[model samples]
Target chain A: METVKFDLEKHTLREVNQYLHSDASVLDGKAVTIDNPNGSHNIAVGLKADVNVTIQGHAGYYAAGMNQLANVVIEGSAGTGVAENMMSGRVHVKGFASNAAGATANGGLLIIDGDAGLRCGISMKGANIVVGGSVGSFSAFMAQAGNLVILGDAGEALGDSLYEARIFVRGNIQSLGSDCEVKPMDDTAKQILVDLLAESGHGDVDPDSFTLLGSARKLYNFHVDNAGDY
Target chain B: MGTKDQLALVRDPFACKPAIIAEHDDYVAIASEFRSLAHLPDIKNAKVFEPAPKEMYVWKL
Candidate 1:
């Protein structure tokens, strides 16, 4: 378990990323530490190995975007689109994340210990996002598939134009957007939320306290009966 | 947009839009996203923070 450390102050982001994007034999199961990120964009992104990477400072846009099989931890807040379009692996933000966090991610887990800004998980194909704090407006908008668990309050239009994705909220929701409505919390959904909470470091929280919100299935197809709503 | 005396950044109360404000010894930088300011010199030591909704960020020379 040798630790590979890179100081962004000395090495450019491209150089550090080149090392991360090296041969699988060099990156697999490796522990990497990046010092002085300084809110840089695209740190630890597109990783394909089972490595653990720690970014010691704040990250800019799309940090760890399109990641796979890696665990990236951001010690400070993230700018925009943290972990956006990820395929697999885990991106954990210890501080708040700005707009579009986890947008369009297909797989893996995104854990935000603090609040997440607007449009979180937008258009997500399949991923698990757990936010310990509140989320801004229009989050989970048009998310086709996946699950978003919010422990704190949600801003306006919490799940606007949502599709098949499920949203679990423990606190109050300012409003539900078009095609988003509360669904019955069945045992299966609760179990899934339980696992998500546990994975996001909230295992002790009661799963039953969450409310499931999903698509009403009214906007998928154009029906003349519901034309006005469309 | 700025003129001569002061520069200002505004965020709507709804906060649908995002803005990041960074201050340094050389200048005060603001952008809708942090990526826009990532390439700036000495950015690693700049004071970075998100602007509050409905607050006016004014810079004086």
Candidate 2:
């Protein structure tokens, strides 16, 4: 496997994305490493490959936006929209993440080892986001599908305006969003979280403390009386 | 009042409390203001709920 090392001290985002995209051709089965990346915006956009990219430091906005079939790992914190509109593969952040980490993603997995800002998976479709720490308010807002597993406390209004997505939080939630309710954690849901946490490298955490959040399906289609709830 | 009377009063169906629809309206307005100030484009205009998910274009701040 070929390896490409990107030293952020001397390279630009344009250089990084170009190199990542181009390297996919030369190093078809290689694992690329971007060493010492410091909050660069759009670092690996629109990359389609079977390679693994390890970013050694913090990343700026949309670090792996629209990624397809590439495993991108950031060793530090990430800014907003880190994996926006991703179609497949995985984006792992070893530390905290900013807002909209996987916004509108159609498919893939996002793993954040630390806390995530608001709307972590807003309008997500088929993307699974597992946060090892707390998630800010409005997480999974209007999520159409997929799963969100929070190993820490979930802030207020969890899963507001949700659609078909499942949320499992291991800590307290300040409030549930309109039409969002806490259902009993059944065996199916519990097993799913356990397996997911394991796959995301958080298998040791306890799963019993988690609560599930989903749409009540009452206000799925807006109505006159339901207007008061919004 | 007797305990039963108090219970009846508590459960009275006709008891009318002034509805604060204005509060809801104000909240909506404030939320919209905040969204605007935060530079969040109105997703209502973008029709995010459409059958086919529309790609939202967002730029870095």
Candidate 3:
């Protein structure tokens, strides 16, 4: 396998990303390693190739935002909005991620090995996120689609104003947001959880231990009975 | 509350600010950004994590 290496301390982020934005034919199937990331923002944003990028150190905000068909791996913790608005491909964060991680993704897979900060998947349209640890308050808020799998505890008001998206948790939930209700785990849900675990290298986790939560569909319409004055 | 001999840390309940904690065998450090700590000795081997909101942590010296 061909590999491209860059040291962020010596080269500008623009240079590295510019090389990444080169024609797909030149960048496909290549392994790009970025050394000394040192908490730089936008380390690998808007990559359209099918290459694999590895950030040697921590990443700052929007590390892999708007990614497509690329695989990005962050060796250290990621700042806010990691993998936000991704269209496709996979991003794996070996350390914890900051607030609004994986926000508004369209299609892709985000794997966080450590805890995620607030709003893990806010307003997600389509995508899948697997967190190996807990998430902060208001995770998956106003999500429209996709699946969020949390392997650890969730803070207050998980999935507030949810829509269509399903959240599965293997640990404790502090509280539920408005219009969010627990759902019985069926065969399909179990299978999905099983597949997600397998994909994220967590197949040993028992699928039966997870609890499913989804929208209650109570906020979709206006209520006239509760109208105090009109 | 802690004495000068102890190392303590805390996070806001809303968690709007950023904080990362790095613990090494020799010492423990906390910073708002990783870049500030990137020059530390043996940083790659440190255990890095974000402190939970509204939680107080104290490391005895």
Ranking by TM-score: 3, 1, 2
Which regions of candidate 3 deviate over 4 angstroms? A224-230, B1-4
Task: Give the DockQ (2 decimals) of all models.
Answer: 0.32, 0.02, 0.59
In model 3 chain A, the worst 10-residue window by lDDT is A221-230
**Model 3: per-residue Cα lDDT at residue A146:** 91
Q: Which pairs of residues collide in candidate 2?
A: none
Q: Write the per-residue lDDT of candidate 2 for residues B1-61, one digit (tens) a residue.
A: 1332221112112111111000121122111111122222432222110010122222121
Candidates 2 and 3 compared by DockQ, better number: 3
State candidate 2's TM-score. 0.76
Candidate 1 CAPRI category: acceptable
TM-score of each candidate's B chain against the true B chain: 0.87, 0.14, 0.88
- Residue A81 alpha-carbon offset, candidate 1, angstroms: 0.9
lDDT of 2 by residue, A71-107 (tens): 9999777777889999999999987777788999999
Best by the TM-score measure:
3
Ranking by lDDT: 3, 1, 2
- Compose the digit string of candidate 1's lDDT tens values, residues A1-230: 87999999899999989998988898888899999887788898898888999999888888999999999999888988999999999999998899899999999999999889888899998999999998988899999999999999998888888999999999999899989999999888888998999899999998888899999999999988977766
Each candidate structure's count of clashing pairs: 0, 0, 0
lDDT score at residue A52, model 2, on the 0-100 scale = 86
| Full candidate order by DockQ, most accurate first | 3, 1, 2
